[model samples]
Target: MSQAAADTMDNTHAAEHGGHHGEHHVLPYTVYFAVYGSLLVLTGITVLVSFAGLGKWSIPVAMAVAVVKASLVVGYFMHLKYDDRLNSLILVVTLLFILIFFAMTFSDMRTRGMIDPVEDNMVLRNEQAAEKAAAAEASGESSEKGEEAHHEGAAEH
Candidate 1:
């Protein structure tokens, strides 16, 4: 075939397939630099917060900073911001589910001690001792004498 005919055929094929025609979306260099700088600044903030002794707030603050950094990376670096709205919604829903899973796991872990069986460990033993001491105090008896008697009974056994 002639060169002109081949060019026409290629154009026709390109039009048939989505009309991409060798086109692409190129982001500016400054945008990438900005994202990099923001990530570095957020890393510094995370380190500073760790050393500042924020205690209970440290983890939450660090997580917030991380989420912001991740958003920037996903939006700009991953080009999700310019992508379809459905993709963004999918990302949001996935993140929401991850947050829910983490919350449930942490809740279960933190409450494990509270729901442990009475015969499980030393925690219940200490609680029982405290309760006995309180009962002795309410009955106008000396807790120290009660403890000594309990020890003597244990020794006899």
Candidate 2:
């Protein structure tokens, strides 16, 4: 093999050579610049997002942007793009577990209104009490009615 071929082999070999081998692989300056540039751009985008009035959609947009930024860091800075299949499998499993957990949690939360009877009952009770209070006040029947009724009942008994 020519010197260029040998150099390329050495670079590729350094990745798989699992030992105290003196052979080292160095990243080019451009890679560093590219990673850092992406990071800066991500920061700028996050800042810009904070300034926008996206209403309820802002949270989803921010989360999507954050996931993209995390993927970039994992693929580039962590060198997962060049890593083995086992590493990717591990990452996929972790993400799957996270998804499952969040899915279950949200499902449970969505069904909470149906599962727990107290929330609707409490709201209905509050509305009924408010209506009754408003009706009583409108009819000029103040709290003294209860007292007067009790007094009249005691006198009759």
Which candidate has the top score in TM-score?
A: 2
lDDT of 1 by residue, 1-157 (tens): 2553454455445444655435443556766887899999999999988999998998999999999999999977886655555678899999899999999999989867865475566576677888977888899887788889889999999
Model 1, position 39, has a per-residue lDDT of: 99
TM-score of each: 0.57, 0.58
The true-versus-predicted C-alpha distance at residue 81 of model 2, in Å, is: 0.3
Model 2 lDDT tens row, 1-157: 2553464455556556554145344545565567778888988898899789888988998898888888878866776654554788899999999999999999988766544265545455677877976787688786788568668989999
Model 1 residue runs over 4 Å out of place are 1-23, 119-157
Q: Tell me the spans in candidate 2 whose CA falls farther than 4 Å from its real position.
A: 1-25, 116-157
Sliding window of 10 residues with minimal summed lDDT for model 2: 18-27
RMSD of each: 11.9, 11.0
Residue-level error in angstroms, candidate 1, position 28: 1.7
